[model samples]
Structure formats: C-alpha cells, structure tokens
Target: MQQVFVFLILACVSSPGTPKSVDVDTDDDVLTGLEKKTLELETQIAGLKTEICALEMKMKEERDSNQNQLKGVSANVSDTMKVVGDHTAALATLRLDIDSLIQSVNSPPPTPAPTDVSVCPGDDWVEHNGHCILFSSESVTWNTAKVRCMYYGAHLMVVDTEELNTFLKIRLRAPDGNSHYVGGIDFGQANWIWDSTNTEIGYTDWRISQPSNGRTEHCLVVCSGSTCQWNDVDCYGNKKYICQKAAVHG
Candidate 1:
C-alpha cells in the first residue's frame, strides 16, 4: 500500500496540481483496520468467559451428587439398627409366652422369670417364676458363695417373681427358715448387682427395705431359718447352705 501510495504521490506531484481529498481517505482506512482488530479480541474474551462459567456449574453439580450419596449411606445404617432392635424385642416376647404355657399345666406352677434368654456359659440356670437355685454344695466365704456359683455350674439365685420366692422358701431349707443369703449385690459397685458374676440385672425382689446399702452392700444372703429375715452380712462368714435340685419334668 505504501509503494502504491508513493507511486500515486509521484504521479500527482508531476501533475499540474494534487487533489487534497486523497489524504482524508487514507486516515479513514487506518481507523477501520484498528476497529476490526478490537472487535475480534472482544469476541475471544466472551468465549473464554462462557467456558469458565460452564466449568463452575459442573463442579457444583458433582459436589451435590457426592453429598446425596453420603445421605443414602447414613439412612441405610439407621434402618439396619432399627431392624435389629425390633427382632430382639420380638424374641424376648416369644420366650415369655412359651414359659407361661409350660407353667400352666404343671400344677405348683413354675414362676415367671426374666428371660435367661441368654445361653450363659455354665449350666443354663433355669428360672421358675423369678427364683433360680443352684444344685451344688461348693464351700465358699460369704462372698465366695456367689463366686463359686459361676465356676461350678450355677449362679447365685436371683428370684424375679413371687412364686419363685415361695418355692425358694420351701427349697432352701434354712435352719432359721427366713430369707437367707442369695447371690445378689454389687457390694462396691454403683448399681444393684447379683452376687454371682455381679449380674447387673434391673428387676428383682428386695423384700421391701432390704438391700439397704444404697450401693454400700457388697454381698447377698437369704434367711430360710425360723427367723425368715434377709440380710447383707460379711462374705467371709461360713454357714450351712442348700442348693436347689432340679425337678423332674415330663
């Protein structure tokens, strides 16, 4: 363009007079070229901005998807726990019903007992009504009576029902014939516990105002002698005791 313009200028300089309009046309062309370059740059900038906006939206959607998955996992875990709890409760009710049916036919009805629903490691000490008796004669201290129960095949008796109490009264055969030493108490623990294995079972028959320790008592003893009073005496004392022998069930 410069060569062409210079050639035209020379041709004009050689002519009689040059035209002034040519200069104005050359300035207008330069302005038009600059405007085109600026417009192209603006288009490219707009395209980049659109791509950035799309990337941000994709990242947000992924985050939301992950959070929803975590929520589903949590809900599944809660449902599983609820199912286990329900089954456990149902099983307990079933055992109670069966025990009651068995007792009805057996005159001198067996007592209602809290489910020994568990398969305790030793001999399964069955509870009639609420009372359970041991069948051994292991010599132990006031405290030892409860301990040996776990080792030899029995737990200190824990009577949960009234029929169990009467049966125990007849079975213990105590010299005094009152409430005698039984296996129940935490002695030094926070809660009321059975002497044998310190079972923390909640339900029990404390003979109103008995087990007065407020958590201070450490042993359980029943009196079957003529006195018929239950007390928590020292565990070291030795006394003549009887264990319940199993009844023959047809």
Candidate 2:
C-alpha cells in the first residue's frame, strides 16, 4: 500500500498534465505484483507448517514405541526375578530337608530295657544279652552243629562283647571239661567271620599263642579250661555247641 501511494505521488509530480487513466493503470500493475509476492510467501509458510507437523508426529510415534519396549523389558525382568525367588525358596527347603536327614542318620538308636532270664522260651534255654541261648549237651561236628542250630530256627552263638563272653564262660562251666563250638569260621580268607551274619568277627577271647595253625584251623571253639578262652580248631572235630536266637517279646 505504501509503494502504491508513493507511485501515485510520483505520477502526479512528474506529469501534472498526464492522462489520469494511464496513471491509474500503472498503479493497478504495481498492486498486482505485490499481491503475487504475498501469495507466494503465504504458500511457502503453509508448506513449512505442514512439514513441521509431520516431523512432530513422527517423533511422537517413536517416543511411544520406545515407551512400549521399556514396559515389555520391565515385565520380563519382573518375571525373571519371580522365577529366581521361587528357586531360591525351593533350595532353602531342600537344604533344610538334607539337614534333617543328616541329623536322623547321626542320632543313635534307642536301647531296649533289660529282660529276665525266667522269661526264656524253654527250660533248656537261658536268657542273656537280649537273646535265648541253648547249650547242646550232645557233641557234633562244626558243620553239623551249624545245621542243627538252623533246624531250631537259630544260629550258632556269637559272643561279640567281653560281658557276653564272661557270661557264657560261667554258664558253660561243668565238672567234666568239654569244648564247645561257636559261630566263627574262616571261609578260606584267613579272616575269621561269624557264620550267623557272615560278618568279620571283631571280638575274640583267644588264649595265649592260640590261632597259630593259620588256615589249617578253620573253626572256633570255646575251651573248657578255667579261663574259658577261645581256640581255633579243626572244623571236623566233635564238640558240644551253643545256639542262640532273639528272645520273644511277650
């Protein structure tokens, strides 16, 4: 509008007598050029606004995608922690169970109360050390004595302790001396093993210089001497035997 006013003033000054129609025509041409430039600038501004809006929308979408991925990662982390916690609890419980099992294994078994000798199964049987023992008066070979004891649902006596050995020595004492077969036998290994359980004998009452025969003397016998010590002997020798069985509860 200013340029239009300026051109009008110039035309009036430079040509006072010029035709008013020509001046008005020149003013119209200038107004048309300014309008075209204004339109072009407005169009460029509109295109720039559209581009800014597109860029903002794209940035917003990217931000939302990143947020969603973060949420998924957080959820996976929570789930992994939960699983780890569960395993930790299970491991703690298993450790407790193992400790309990170890304690049970290490604890000793309860000892039963002592029983009276009168409660033995028969008149010929004697109660000693939680067992009922029968001392056979008849003599037999070691193998035959073992079979005879089995016939009575018993095994040859196994004296595993010093007290039991002393008790048997007193019980087997008689005016006429006689040897008795016990449970021990060497099964070609040179180590004396109890026939009752096939376990190596851990206790013995061997007399001085006895068991000197090595493999030749494969059987055990309780001698009738005053000391009533043990001696390795020939398995085929005839001897009285002792049989033993667990005592009846009732």
lDDT of each: 0.60, 0.86
lDDT of 2 by residue, 184-220 (tens): 9987567888988999899888888877667568888
What TM-score do all the candidates reach, one by one?
0.36, 0.50
The 10 consecutive residues of candidate 2 with the worst lDDT sum are: 112-121
lDDT of 1 at 142: 53
| Model 2 TM-score relative to the real fold | 0.50
Instruction: TM-score for candidate 1, please give it.
Output: 0.36
lDDT tens string, model 1, 1-250? 9999999999878875444577778878988988888899889889988988898899889889888988998899899889989998998999999898788767685677755342322364444533344544445565555556555555556654566656666656456453345666554653566544445756554445666664345566665335454555555666534343233332
- Residue runs of model 1 more than 4 Å from their true location after superposition: 1-132, 135-139, 173-175, 195-209, 214-216, 224-229, 240-250
